[model samples]
Target: MNNKTKSILYGTLASSILLGVYFTVLTLVSGWSFTQ
Candidate 1:
């Protein structure tokens, strides 16, 4: 894998993790149950 591909993969992984965390926090704050 080239540097560009590695960088893109890292960026995508980071963004997805951040987005998941944000949504999890939002759900908790909104009192939505995750285990339904």
Candidate 2:
């Protein structure tokens, strides 16, 4: 694989992980708020 392709793949993977974490945190916060 080429360097450019490798970087793109890594960046995409990182972005997906970050988005997943953001959503999970958001849900947790909302759930906690609901319980109050």
Candidate 3:
């Protein structure tokens, strides 16, 4: 894989993990409800 492709993959993975952590924290704080 090229440097560009590796960078893109890493960026995407980091963003997704951050998003997942944000959502999980939000859900826990909101008592497992999607509506916040």
- Where does candidate 1 stray beyond 4 Å? 33-36
For model 3 the local lDDT of residue 8 reads 100
Q: If the candidates were sorted by their lDDT against the true structure, best first, what order would they fall in?
A: 3, 1, 2
lDDT score of residue 27 within candidate 1: 85
lDDT of 2 by residue, 1-36 (tens): 999999999999999999999878877988766545
Best-fitting candidate, measured by lDDT? 3
What digit string (tens of lDDT, one per residue) describes model 1 on residues 6-30?
A: 9999999999999999988888877
- lDDT string for model 3 (1-36, tens) is 999999999999999999999888888888765744
Model 3 RMSD in angstroms: 1.7
- In candidate 2, stretches whose alpha carbon ends up further than 4 angstroms from where it belongs are 32-36
Residue-level lDDT for 25 in candidate 2: 85
Spell out the clash pairs found in candidate 1: none
Clashing residue pairs in candidate 2, if any?
none
Per-model TM values vs. the true structure: 0.82, 0.82, 0.81
